[model samples]
Structure formats: structure tokens, C-alpha cells
Target chain A: MADESGVLVLGDSTGGELSSMSRELLTAGRKAADDLGEELAIGLLGATLDQPSQQAISYGADKVYAVTHPQLAQYQVDLYLAAMEALCRDVSPRIVLIGRTNEGRELAPRLAFRLGVGLAQDCLEISVDAGSKTLLANRPVYGGNAIAVVRCNYTPQIAAIRPKVYEPLEPDSSRQGQVVSFPVELDPSQARSQVVNVVEEAAEGVKLEDARVVVSGGRGLGGPEPFKDLETLANLLGGAVGASRAAVDSGWVPSSYQVGLTGKTITPEVYITVAISGASQHMAGCSGAKVIVAINKDAESNIFKEARYGVVGDWEQVVPAFTEAVRELTQS
Target chain B: MPVSIAVLAKQVIDPEMPMAAFRIDADAKAVVPPSNIPPVVNGFDENAVEAALQIKDSQEASITVISTGTSFALDVMKKPLSMGADELVLLQDDAFENSIDSFFTAQLLAAAIRKLGGFDLIICGRQASDWDNAQVPLGVAEILGLSCISLGKKVEIKDGKVSVERITNDGYEVVEAPLPALVTVSNELGQPRYPTLRGIMAATRKQPTIWSSADLDADASQLEPRITLQELFVPVRDQQCEIIEGDDAADAGRQLALKLREAKLI
Candidate 1:
């Protein structure tokens, strides 16, 4: 079903690992297509398409425009944006959705500007109005306290959706897709950025963004050493370790694990904050957590107000009890 | 040559308030306003101001601050101008309250910047706090047709091209592009500077250049929303917290272990 405004989903495959974000985009795109009564087309831009193209179909893309170029092997903004502009011009999509990963965060705005349209970034949810065919994009605003519904009056209403905000449907390996080869021409010398290396995270169990249970630590833990207990609990539960901006700025954890307005936004089943004094900045990252447990020495800490369960005790004593109790319960 | 840089900033509700203070209208897909919402410069845009200051710190440059909102919102956006800005542009309009979307927001700023002229660089936070769509920089870059870099954590200008270190989960990617490009700053870019007393005095006396939609030369049709937000709602939070029943310390461990296993973990 094609309408006045078509849908184009964009994905970037780095070193053969189709970004989890790309998969999430496909999921959202598939749903948007069904709701809008439009065909979903995907643009896979990279140096190669061997593994990613297949994954795109499994995730739910009907047609894939694969552009393989030597210069594209590296994620160059100019090259990629230029290619995307060309693709959008050819397809004339009413809505262009990209993942809020590093590339999408940068590219969508540029693409929207080039097309002279409106663009929404890092949206949590997007839907199309049946009669008007207008896209209603919902995203966190003012940290995480408020959400704004954005509508683009212009054509090619482009947007970047955050990863993990939406759940992906089970992949059907049998799903087939049409592969349209897009020939990309680029000058190697024209690109300013070169991919010197790719460093992957070595964490096991659940990825940070996709984690169900998140165990977070803050400055109240006193030092970085105490977080070992928190990490142990997270690992045992097959979850991820998150940190407050205080802990990250204190060098207790890498900035990657930081959760706050300036850090990663997560929505987990359970979030346990150890020795953390709740600040608006820190809480912004974890407000979406379903269950919050705060263990702190300060009885009047603001974290208690946000916590489902509050333990007004030392972290050293509480973390061990919580961990040991879980250990025994699981063992039984 | 040092580039002229302009930053568009906005005041947004603090998102990390307690549930008691916030409410979500799930059906409307919008968050209900809490009475105690504190104002702050949108997170990503602070990095933009810092990026502009960095360019000024390294070379001879003029950085201006532009904001679109109520006069009361001035305190939220003016801090950066005092920290180290050469000028300030304010587009205060009542319609701006509902027109926070990046498209029109960009149009408002682009009109002012275009009128100012002689700008070699533009910096914006990836997104505003209230909108958090991260679209303005790319939109402004596109409207101007200059190259654009988003999530730039580190930036340097040399030989008419700006080199930037963009932060990614994998690490940082270094890219260089020609001048007259737009760069959106990442949180890791650097800490924003506090305004000095002398700088504060200057900002107090400084008259921000004001422009209306008429002055901007923007199409009224383009200003009209393509998408309409019918309603706003806040999400409801429900948590089921259960305490483990046990006697001795070791026994408590057993109870906790049982719960973990019940959740399918060893």
C-alpha cells in the first residue's frame, strides 16, 4: 500500500555487526507501514552488504537499496549524507526514519534540512494519522519528565528513533526482500574522517541499552572499589551496570555506563541505585525503569521518593544482603 | 581566520522529577506538566555553546547566543552569553511556546543568522530539552548547505576545514570537513564555563537583537505545522516491590537466591 508519503528506513552496518538500532528501526518501520498503508523500503549504506542486508529482511524490510562503495566502508558524514540525500530524492519518502545511533543522530537532521522538511530526533514512539497521514512522533523532552508530540508539516518528515524504545518482533528467516543495488561514487580524498579502528564492548549477559535489570551506583558508594558488589549483582541477574553522573565524573565508572540527562537513557524492569543521592540529571536517565530500589545512608535523600523500596542503611551492608538473598533464592 | 558562531538555546522542563510531581497522558502521547519543573538549558545544546567557545578560545572568533522563548526564559539561555559571547539574539514570540519543533525553530534562527551574515560556523545542541529531537543542527546546516557534524565531542578548525572527534559507543571517530559547516556538540565535548563577574555585567547591559517572523524572510506556510500535537500526557509508573521473608543472615541469602532463580537466573 503506497500513499502520498512513503517510508524509508535507514541502517548502517559497521564491521558486519548490523547495529541493534537498525533492527529496531526496521521493527518500527514495519509497524508504521502497516498503519499508514504504505510499502516499507530500507536504505542500507555501507562498504558491504553481505550480512546486514539479510538481517534487514529478517527484521522486516520489504525492499533494500544497497549502496556499496569503498569510501562508504568508513562512516563519513559527507559521503553518507550525500548518499542518503540522493536516495531520499529518488524515493521521495514522506517519512524517513533512522536509528538514534551515532550516525542517525547526525544524519537525520542534515537529511531533513537538505529536503527542506521537518525532522524529529531520538523519538521514543511514532505513529501516522490514518486520515491526515501525519506522523505523530513522541519523544522525551526536558530531560525525561515531559514528552512532546511532534508533527512535520513538510514532506519527507525525517526523524531519528532511539534504540530499545520499541520492542522488535520475532524475526522470520523466511521473509523475502527485493534488493536494489544503488551505485555509489565517492572520492576517497574528499572525506575528512577515517575509521582508524573499531573497539567493541566486552560485557557479557545483557547489553546496556537492552538490559532488563540495571544495577546502578553513585558517589555515595564512597569509592570505585565498592561498585564490585553492584557489578556482581548485575552480572548474576544477567543485567547491566549503570552509573550516576556523579560516579562517572568521579572516575569510578566510564562515561559509557553513566546514566543521566547527559548520559544513556534506559528503561529496565528493575533499577537498584546504590548509595546514590538522586539529582534531576541522574534520575533523567533511569526514570523509565519499572522498579527502583534505593539503598543509601542518608535517610532524607531524594532517591527514596523515586524508589519503590528504600533501605535506609549503609550500602556496604545492604548490597551484600540483597545480593546474598538473591543468591540463596536462586539456588533454592 | 576565526569563524563567527551562533548557538540556538532553549529552556526545558527538568525530566528527572519524582512520579508524584509528574503525570503521563498515555493516550495523547505527551507528558503532563508538573508544577515544580525547573528550567535548564537543554543538555545537548550546552555542549554546542562550549564548542563555540572552544573555537573562540583557540582563535580570534565572535560567538553569539540566540534564543526563542519568553523573556522569563532569558535567564535559562543567557548564562552562556555571559560566560563568553560577543552578542545575543532573542526571538521572543508567544507562538514560540507551541512552536518548539526543530523545523520552525530552525527557521526562526536561520532568519536571524542570515540577517547577521558573515558567519563561518554554526553550533547547536543535538536537540533541545523540551523537544529532544536533535534535529536543529542538521536542519540549520541543510538550510545553509554547509557541511554538518552531529555528536562532535572534540572540534578544531584549521585551513578552512574543521576537524572533529565524534563520540560513538565503539570509541571516537575523527572527521574533517570544510568551514561554514554546522557542528552539534556531544556531552563529552567539555564542561561549560561559568560566567565571570565582568562578563555578567556585560551581559546585563547587552541588548539582545530581536527579530519577528517578518524580519526572518521565512515562508508562512513553512512556519505552519505539518504535524499537530493534539494532546500531552505523562506516563504512569507502577512498581511492585516485595521484601524477602527470612530469619538468619544465611537464610536471607537463600530467600534472595530463590527469588533470583524464580526469575530464571542461577
Candidate 2:
């Protein structure tokens, strides 16, 4: 008999490779499944998901469901929704976990709505409630000022977990699991919105999320020119350049580089914030950094309160000298 | 025929509330509304209204603003009206109090839209500032079975088709969809315009059409929230500061670099 009680994880893939976030979800799902004394299942939806399905099992999924079709190559909201909804109705899992990526954020809500269930988005933590045998999702709210623990009263509890919050388990190559191929019929005419083109922004160096060291600037930089200096510092440290929402809104940098509640959450080893008065919103994203360094002309800036090290000085005078010193130190 | 559009708006706690004053009651599992800070229209929802207004400015169109909440302050509800929306439809009922997740919220809003009859387009914020779920627009689109374009930074309508610049993880994609579709506007659309004095005066004379759960024949039990708040708490940060001493600005920079190197950060 098909397992009626299991934790179902949605595996998202891009460019024919399983996303790291999907792996993290599997790790989290494994823990939740262990707690509930249930099985862990993963669902991969795309055109050709053979490799990803095997990878899901290796990461700890006991069973993998691969839903494939020609129209499923690129993510179409309606198409993915229909396939997942069908799979959920057939399997009837107790909990559904999805990554809070662009695709996951778009899919989780619609799936929950279709199933007449509740969804918690961008959750920081997920755990099983021992008493009710339900899932508890902890998420940041009020622009990251507070945390709320929420539980789904209905079955098939759904949640969208944030990337990097949970660590993925090391894949065991020898692990074996069942792979089920579920085929679904998709009508091309049903898709109203089609992706015309996906243009990747020409990014240099490491991505903000993966960077070990991050050098971020704020409105205090005055203009976009000073960001080049921050980039130089980031390059010298082998890190990536980030920005505050103000700087991005000021047209100094692209939204991709923004670090805050509305932007990307980064947990680098060292976070150097320059010319940025630390707003609670910006700090919410980078608070997990091991060390925070603030450089601003204002000694009383809010950033200093949150920083482990504070330097009261103009960024123009401090950043260049700091960049040169780092170059020399790294060279030695 | 002139284009008819419905822009979804929401009233939320002030996002700009200072951190020092922000508080949550763990016992109540609710955010304690800071007495000084009053609830306002969600910033992104206003951006959705702005997107609608821009379209109305270029062509002959009618814009109706809609919201679903238990008790919406009139001042907050009138914001879009004061910003040039032709009508406001509010779904307010005791049945919607304290519960109703985004799914049910969308279902109720969709029912109201259907009752409104003719609408060529529906626009909403990518997400609300409070829950930050970014789900309702997609949920509404799903319930209505309409083409949905999300994270739209730029939207335009011409000849029964909509063109949008949709924000993606990498960058953005230019997408086109047919009429009667829903688009979730992002902050990239730019700041919503402030209401003019004339617009505010005109709004004073307009009364919003209020509907209860019974009005839409919504199943009361189906409207119950799927997710329940278990607990609310403030996160504590434990860190101590170490000021990097220097002779001057450049010296401080040097000292900071040396300290980072000693810590094996660079």
C-alpha cells in the first residue's frame, strides 16, 4: 500500500542540475519524517528529471516521483501547479516542504490553495509538533523584526523554507530508493503566460549567497562610482559586493546585490558594511555573519551598534587604504 | 470598450515602525500594535495601484480597488481612492476575523471580483509587507483560472494583450499574456504617487461597497485559516563590539585590515 503519511519534498532543478536548496529541503524533510515516524518522499517535475530523481534518493529520499513532460521544461506556474496537485491527491502526504526560491515561492501558495490547505512562506525553521504530529514553521515577520511560529491545522501542511537556513546532508552514492515515473498530460493551450527569454545579469566573482566575505555599501557612498572601490575591496578579499536597499533604489546597484529583508539573506564569515547606517531591515539579512565591520563618518550610526568592530571615518578615505592593506596582507 | 481593471490593496501595520518600538505578545501570539504607529496601506499594494493608474493615464480605462480584511480603517482604505481609483470594494465580515490564510483570502477576493462582473485585468502587490508571503496574487489567479504574471516591474496593456518585465532570480524576463490576466507588481515599478488635494476631496464623496461572507455565499467553514499562529517572540542578538583604534582614518583602515587578517577572514 502507498504510504499515506510521509513528508513530501518538492525538488527544483535548473539547467539540468538539481538545485542545492532542493537538497537542503531533503535534509530537513528527513528530520521531519524521522520525528513523525513516516517516510520521506521527493517529487521532481521537469522535462528530463532522471538524474535529479536519483540524486534525490541519494540525498535521503526513500522514494522519488519524477513527473516529466515536454511542456514542463521551463517553469510554467499553471503547468507545475496541475502536476503537483495531481501527485498530492494521489499520494496524500502529511507535510509538503518546498524551497523558498523564485519557483518555490510561486508554487507553494497555489498548491496550498488548490488543496484547500495552509502555507507558510520563507520559513527559517521547520520542526514536528510531537503532540499533534503536525509541522511547525518558524518565519520572520514585521520586516524581520520578530519571529512567528505557525502550524497548519489541515493535513498536507505546506511550507516554503528559505535557502541556506538548513544544511544539506552529504550524499551517499551507494544509497538506493524507489524511483516512480508519473506521467501527466499537459495542454499547451492552457498556458496563458509564457517565458519569452531569461537573460542572466552579467555577474562577476562569487554570488552574494556563496561569498565568504561580503563588502556592502549604502547611500553614504553618494553615487555608483564608490561601489567600484567596494568591489575592488571584495575582489582583494575574494568576496562579493553587496548593497543596501537604499543604494539599489538609488540606482547605484542592481536589485540582485541588495541585502536586506526584501533582498537576499547572506551569512558570510566577514561582513564589511561601508557608508551604511545599519537599519534593522539590512541587519536582519546579515546578522548571522561571524564578524561585522562598520565604516561610517557618523560615530553614532546604528550600524556601529550591531558591528563587532567600528571605524568612524569617511569611506572614501578608509576604504582605499583598507583595500591596499588587505592586498598587502593577503600577498604576504 | 474601455479597459476595466481591479487593483488589490491591503491595510497592514506600518512596516517603517522603528525597531525599538516593535513588540510582540508571546501569550497572545500577536504583534502588539505600537500605539504611536497607525496601520497604513501596504507599500507594495500602493505600487500595484500606481501601476493601474499609469495605465489609466495613457488610455481610457476604469480602475476598481479591492481589499479583504476584517476591520479596515477607512483612512487606510481610501488611500487608493484618493490616488485616482474609480471604485473600492471591501470584503469585511466577522467571519474573516483573526484567521483566513492567503488561500481563503484569495478565494474571498476572487468571489468579489466575479461579482463585480466585467474586468479586463487584475493587479496586486508581489506580496504583503506583514506576512511577506507573496502568495495571494498567484492564489487569486489560480482560483479565477487566469493567466498569472508575477514579480512584474513594468506592465502595459494594449489591444487586449499585456506586456510585462517580470523579475526573476537571475535578472528579469519580458513576458506577454492575454487580457483578463493577473499581474503582481513589484517595488521595481517605482514609488506610488501621493494623493493630490483634489483627488482626496473627490474620494470623500465616494463610499466603498462592503460585502460580508454571506453576500458572496462563501462557505464559512472553508474560510477558516489552514495555518495557526503557535507562538511569537523577539529574536535576541548577543554580540559585543571591539573598536579598531587608529591614529587617523587611514590608520584605522590599516588596523581593521590587520585585525581581519589575524582572524583569518582575508
Instruction: Give the winner by DockQ.
Output: 2
TM-score of chain B of 2: 0.95
Q: Which pairs of residues collide in model 2?
A: none
Give the Å shift of residue A161 in candidate 2: 0.5
Candidate 2 wrongly placed segments (more than 4 Å): A1-3, A298-302, B98-100
Task: Kindly list the per-residue Cα lDDT of model 1 for residues A1-332, writing each as its tens digit.
Answer: 14446689988786796677788888888888888888888898987897888888888988889988887776677788878888888887878898876566677776777776767766878998878887888866655555667777777877788766776678888999888999866776555444444444335567677788888999888788987888888887778898887786576766677777656778888887888987755776787777777777786777876886666666676678778767555456
Predicted complex 1: CAPRI docking category: acceptable
**What's the true lDDT of residue B189 in model 1?**
70
Q: Categorize the docking of model 2.
A: medium
lDDT against true structure, model 2: 0.85
- Per-residue lDDT over B61-118 for candidate 1, one digit per residue giving the tens place of the 0 to 100 score: 9888877764545666678878888887878766765444667777777777788884
B89-136, model 2: which lDDT tens digit per residue? 989987665342676787788889888994899999988877777888
Candidate 2 interface RMSD (Å): 1.6
Top candidate on TM-score is 2
- What are the TM-scores, per candidate, against the unseen true structure? 0.84, 0.95
